[model samples]
Target: MTTTSSPLTQDELKAMVGQAALRYIAPGDIVGVGTGSTVNKFIDALATIKDQVRAAVSSSEASTARLQAIGIPVLDANAVEQLSVYVDGADEIDGHGYMIKGGGAALTREKIVAALAQRFVCIADESKRVATLGQFPLPVEVIPMAAQQIARRFAALGGQATLRLKDGQPLVTDNGQHILDVHGLRITDPLAFESAVNQWPGVVTVGVFAHQKASVCLLGTASGVETLTY
Candidate 1:
């Protein structure tokens, strides 16, 4: 990866990487699109090439609307057997490409879409890269009845889990489940932690993307976009 001399603003960097992601697309391919602001930039860029790809499989309803609004077709994930690439942003991505996502409360769907893709291409500003995971709170979608029980499980693991709130009430996910954002964790073994948490009864999906880790990352820097291949 190389850097440019002149520095660019954060939004400029995001747009730069967003536009750069277009190179990964192949004509007539079905793309797996993710959610978030950085990804929103990618979605806008995708509109310019809407006719190139057959259709998009979005991770959230919001993204589906955006794609349809731009005249790009959106397909149900069940209809697509596999995708050429899944482009999404990470809340925190480590050296190994493992990430903590779901900051947008779309973790469950994001993971589902990611599972249907052959490649996971993570797009992010440089700030999202980290030496280790877990500085950002880990989001876990849980069955409502087990919210408190799940929180206690995190406490036993030395982390604090709190129900995510919006409008002074529990924020419900698209799956009609509640989210528990766990804090105070330093995830050295993301795969193991993810496996363990997922085994808990109430857990629908854990924010850790170890199994569906990124194959490549387009990191936006002050200078330009840096490509990292894992």
Candidate 2:
């Protein structure tokens, strides 16, 4: 398939990557969909091949509704025993597959479904790639009652944590909790930081997905889509 010579725009490249993702998905595969612009593009591309595969489980309602609207079947996370593959977008990714997701507030469910998949394929533009995992702020969800305390706790860990808000209100997750975006973490041990945050009282979930690593990362670039395997 020939693409534009002048480098497809970011949105155009994302769409290309989304279409490319379909090739790896076989018929009768139960896939997990992650959140973000790239995944949205993937859903649009998947619509063309909805009948080519089995139903997909989405981590966010936004994606679920989009899939259904495009004639692709949608299933709940618990509805499937094992996912053949998961193609989702990531906020930031490291060489080792350590990532900071949940910019879409679906990180918790995304990670849950990803854990059950044999392979998690992270789709993103070249810009999403980072040398380290924490250059981007990490999103952590907490109960409304404890969001402040959790933010303080995250700050104490040498990171800046702010309760994510929208239009003067705290941003709430699909699980009905507030989100704290932690910035400036030099995370060498993502698992350790994940554990430390989870141990905090009233912490609902953190965006660190160290427990589930990406089997492959599809980076859409001005040049083209480059595949990275961990």
Candidate 3:
């Protein structure tokens, strides 16, 4: 007795789990769509059920367009009252619920959207589950005017930082800011790190998403989808 292949690629895996997680999505509930390959699958899945929900807010412009294209009513963030549930994908998740996000460069909006939601649901592959965060470089969204200053600050803190770029020009976020992906910050306390980065001027947002606790995490593995509750 054996099982068939769950999915061939990561995108396929995301769709399988994302559709399963839709069981929790209810009508008339405000939703937030996260940015990432996994979240892309979730968005694609949501397109099928767009008319089933009330309204949606996107963490990235890219996601908003996709949602609109599928007939999912998109709401202005300023007009939004309260988000019922925020469905996002985590770059890394530990047992304590701490996570490192922004691998897709929308950390600022992602955090904002997550905070507006009452519950945050993280969807990812098995590889994203970890005992601790910080094996990867942490992305910090910064104002273009202060990118160099921010880099100097990180250097003083004994961390190497690089400004993400596109075709010789600086990479601009959806919000029109630069991203300084800092390396070698041993984040013993993700909450503290998030605050520390926030303390900096022109620091729009950091990839460290501790405030958004995962009420539930939908993890796709070789066996199948696994739901872990916080």
Candidate 4:
């Protein structure tokens, strides 16, 4: 495989990591899929192995549709007992494997599918790697009625919370929840913040993946695919 040299384009890196993720899929195993641009490339890669894997449990409707379009069966997460791997991308990832995800507004389902998988393989371009989490705004899925209250709570925590909007309207998740992207947080304690935010009323899921952190990260760099474990 020819890797892009120094000054690699984002697409090139995504494709590299996306193709590398196929190595984690075993014959007849149910794969867990997540949403986003990088994962879109992974879905494309997965199409080549459609017949080898049994089925896939997607974290969002977008991924499910893509998997089905590529001749890969999309199954309900409830029907699947075990998943060999969960492949997803992150907004920001630290060396410890903790990540800030949900930029696609699929945080709730992504977290659920991630929890069900045996291995969480985060595929991303090198730009996402960070020394600490929270450079990218952390996404928090919350009930519609609680949006303002949650925003206020995040403000109290020194975060600037903004309701995610799409096409001039509030963006709604597959679970019919709204997303609050919180900024200005340099999360030095991911586990503690994740737990604190999770206990807040009306919070569906926090973007922090501290509890279900990645088992491995396939980071695409100018040199090659750099593998990191936590």
Which candidate should be chosen as best, given lDDT against the real structure?
Answer: 4
Candidate 2 clashes between residue pairs 3 or more apart in a chain or in different chains: none
lDDT (10s digit) by residue, model 1, range 1-230? 99866677778878888899999999998899999888899999999998898999999988888888998899999998889899999999999999999999999999999999999999999999999999999999999999999999889888999999999999988889999999999999999989888899989999999999999999998767899999
Candidate lDDT values, in order: 0.93, 0.85, 0.84, 0.94
- List ranges where model 2 is wrong by over 4 Å: 1-5
Q: Candidate 4 at residue 16, lDDT?
A: 92
Write the residue-wise lDDT of candidate 4 on 1-230 in tens digits: 99954687899899999999999999998999999999999999998988998899999999999999999999999998888799999999999999999999999999999999999999998999999898899999999999999999989879999999999999989999899999999999999989999999999999999998999999999889999999
Worst 10 residues of 3 by lDDT: 4-13
* Count of clashing pairs, candidate 1: 0
Candidate 2 structure quality by residue, lDDT tens digits, 1-230: 98756757889978978988887799877778888889999988888778886888989889989988987788877778898899998888888887889899888889888988999998888888888788888988788898778778777879888878899998778898888888888888888888888788997778887788788988898778899999
lDDT of 2 at 218: 87
In model 1, state the lDDT of residue 182. Answer: 94
Which scores higher on TM-score, 2 or 3? 2
Native-structure RMSD, model 2 = 2.7
Q: What TM-score quantifies how close candidate 4 is to the native fold?
A: 0.96
Candidate 1 has which clashing residue pairs, if any?
none
Question: If both were scored by lDDT, which would come out higher, candidate 2 or candidate 3?
Answer: 2
TM-score for all predictions?
A: 0.96, 0.94, 0.92, 0.96
Q: What is the lDDT of candidate 4?
A: 0.94
